[model samples]
Target: MNKILLSVLLIFCGTSVFSQDTLLTILEEELEREFKVLSKAEVPVYYMDYRVEDETALTITSSFGSLMDESNARMRVLQPTLRVGNYKLDNTRELANYYGGGYFGANQAQYLPINNNSKAIKQVLWRVTDFAYNNAKERFQEVKNSDIKNEIDDFSKEKPTKYYEPPALGSLDESYWKNTAKKLSAQFLGDSKIISGTVTISGSFSRKYFVSSEGASVVQNFNFIQVFVSGEVVNEDGEIASLYNSYTASNEKGLPSFDTLMAETKSLVENLQKLKEAPFAEPYTGPAILHPRVSAVFFHEIFGHRIEGHRLKSEQDGQTFKEKVGSQILPDFISIYSDPTLKNVEGIELSGNYKVDDQGIESRRVEIVKNGKLQNFLMSRSPIEQFSNSNGHGRSQIGADPVARQSNLIIETTSNISDDKLRKQLIEECKKQNKPYGYYFEDVTGGFTQTSRYATNAFNIMPTLVYRVYADGRPDELVKGVDLIGTPLAMFAEIMQAGKSIDVFNGICGAESGNIPVSAVAPAILVRRIETQKKPIVDIKAEEPILASPLLNKKN
Candidate 1:
């Protein structure tokens, strides 16, 4: 009978004209029928999420000769959740703590079981609904009737919105995938010889369907494409050093051009070769200039993570800036903002733009810091005491709960100092401090930070290309084996100046739940006083006897 009703609704709506209203109507009718069976127990809240993903990948790997691997796959996932908190215990402790603390309990479980068959996709909705209903009932039965009534009354305060419908999946095909792969590969290969390198191109198109018992339904689609190129050179000491570049786009046209990527790859290879003989430096602290890319890492690891709303809620967190709000945390010339609605910056497309967040709320721009003063915190539905509404910053991986997460972080500076001036200033500062040389961080890999109160609140900014600028006006020397480390508050206070040029760093960030693509943009920055620690050196001995093969041939 349910199948018959769904089929009838589909036929009535037609494939091309199936709007959000039509989908919601169908879901409402189905939910009403299911609710009749739960007359003995009241349903407090329920939600459903359905997602379909189509993926294609092409990979080239080199052990001796390059081997190609390609795959095309699609998958659909369905999740339904129901909450019944109305069942209350007569115990005073249970009545006092309503949200998961009392005798009234809340539980959630995934309805979709692991399956290899095609029929698994079709069973998602039915299975999830059944599971949620059953799970809610079991919990409701444990509580007293009076407590159940009180919990239901509390849950009734907020009403869910109308159904939401996402944009349609226009078209997708193999040709589109192949062409994109070809373009990305050609860009990275350029005129260089086929040295030891690998290229991987992958893309996904995801469609989502969401429904709730409170008359809310939504369907949306998201598209993603990524291309990655990696190459490595082993030093005489058997230290394997590698470089990688990745490009992500919502559509094919937004990706970097072939020429641009080829140039980057060539440059990466050259840098790796240079690093083969680079010497490590002893730990020191004086003056340092962080290039735009390095500055992005500094900001993301140091500042961005510290501002998440969940961290503020945890008493264990340092809450570095909680009391410092309305005070100057950064230089007057610096301004930072995070906006999910921004599709581009300085004509470059941003990967963080999205119409709605994971929790079905519209995305908005969050002014994290305005002209050096702390402004607001990224918020999810979990409101802190001082913050009441959601700014739609909540995000998470599929099947994970959402929390306040960063989007596109833009660090703006009003200073007009150039790269040369920044270096000159660093040298002057080194002279004043009676130091032999200062540091310049030209490039970086990503970094991490610990914001909890248990440990010293500090961050380590890893540098790929670091230099020592002598106070005697001698040539800048390339050095390795030092990481930029400092306390956030002290570092912020020591920010001496910023440069005019800006650079963008794009990559994936891994946290509690999973990894997500994030971008950071900033200009070169100068800090008066910073510290570094010696990176632990590996004791691997160099492999003996260079191969006499032509693959070892060096360029003139």
Candidate 2:
């Protein structure tokens, strides 16, 4: 009886200790197991990352029954990934050479068949380890048969010390988000005279714990808030005009005040009224000035996308800056950089702030162009021949593969020219070119670019608000129906000057994988020459007006 009791006590004590281990501790133990397996298998190169992400979100939406629908949700995901390369069985030179080439790999979802408990995470890890070992073994055999020696030798280069700790959790308050929506809605209805509308405010907080077999352990936290307000207006022409304003922030205090947002909405309504009277512009090629907001779109669509490292390696990409490294790409007065470390610009917290990138690399600034000279390209873990390591720009949405992406792009100008001076110079250039007027792009909606080498290598920058600055000192004319179009190389060559005052634009950019928040800070820029094509317009005949709701019409 005594011997049985002692055995039972020992078993119970061991179980309790294992159960009490923190999630981080358990994750480390799993990594150790993976390392041991790799050594036993004699894999030449291997990498394994185990991560657990805990996410909480509060969302509010518009509904008929309930003016606002508010709900909270929490979820956790365990992701374990593994890669193996260069396995050789024999000492033969040819076999060794064949195994040296880098291995191509794919990610497999490790499902936990067990219930949603902490121990389930361990099961997920086990699944990934088993899959990776089996896959590597199969791939090694294939490499031996191919006898591709030179390629295998190239795969053994190990890069070093690019890891970064995760950022701290910023402040977040659910009440604040809820109240912001309520306040913005009330202001729009009461002050802006918006008849019907909807507002959605959402907050997301995520915590990620990562452990790798290469002795890397990190924990990161992030919080974000987004507010969206949309409204509709029926004009005198019986056409409905819709306006949307969105706000995003990593820190709560950085969001605009309720009154400020209300004022902007009121102005937006006023602009929609003017848009009804705005005339469509004819296609013209002339000197133009892109205001900061418009200029941001220009840089992002034309320049930023082309410099992503992955695009350069693809045979389809134009590789605009590849051969222009030592040459000037922009005017001598302008310099451009993309940095993720910057959290704020002129007191506003930018949305792109993150401590570590998706690939566990530390975020760093990449200066693509300095003083008009082509410099460097944004990099991620996937190495190209020229660029080997990540500059902390690798990013992706949840469940998507991380890739090289832009963060906060800053365009700095060395010139001391004022906005008015830039416009005046544009008019002079127009006169010199014998054109009646130049264009001033005041604001933008968004734009797209084509980076493929097979195509025309052009970009279309859509402008929402544009004006013609007459060379003969005529009144500025508001016009629509124009889209800024040009090639990257030609556009960069035409940059004449930049303005003194800086403007900041915050928004999200959608690419192949997903949408990610980004910001652009720049001053108004003057380009001596640019090209534009007329946007296609609809020629709809007159139709009956869609009446407003009875309740709203009665109030009006």
How many clashes in each structure? Answer: 6, 8
| Root-mean-square deviation per candidate | 7.7, 9.6
lDDT of all the models against the reference? 0.64, 0.68
> What's the alpha carbon RMSD for model 2?
9.6
Off by over 4 Å in 2: 1-21, 42-45, 62-68, 86-105, 109-116, 128-176, 182-198, 231-243, 534-546
lDDT of 1 by residue, 263-320 (tens): 7866776676666677778989788899998998899999998887766655567888
Candidate 1 segments whose C-alpha is farther than 4 A from its true place: 1-43, 46-65, 86-122, 129-196, 538-546, 549-556
lDDT: which candidate is best? Answer: 2
Q: Model 2 over residues 197-258: C-alpha lDDT tens digits?
A: 66787777777666666555556677888877766544344444445677778766767887
lDDT of 2 at 422: 93
TM-score of each: 0.79, 0.81
- TM-score of candidate 2 to 2 decimals: 0.81
- Which candidate number would show the highest TM-score if scored against the true structure? 2
Scored against the true structure, residue 484 in model 2 reaches a CA lDDT of 96
- Give the per-residue Cα lDDT of candidate 2 at 346: 85
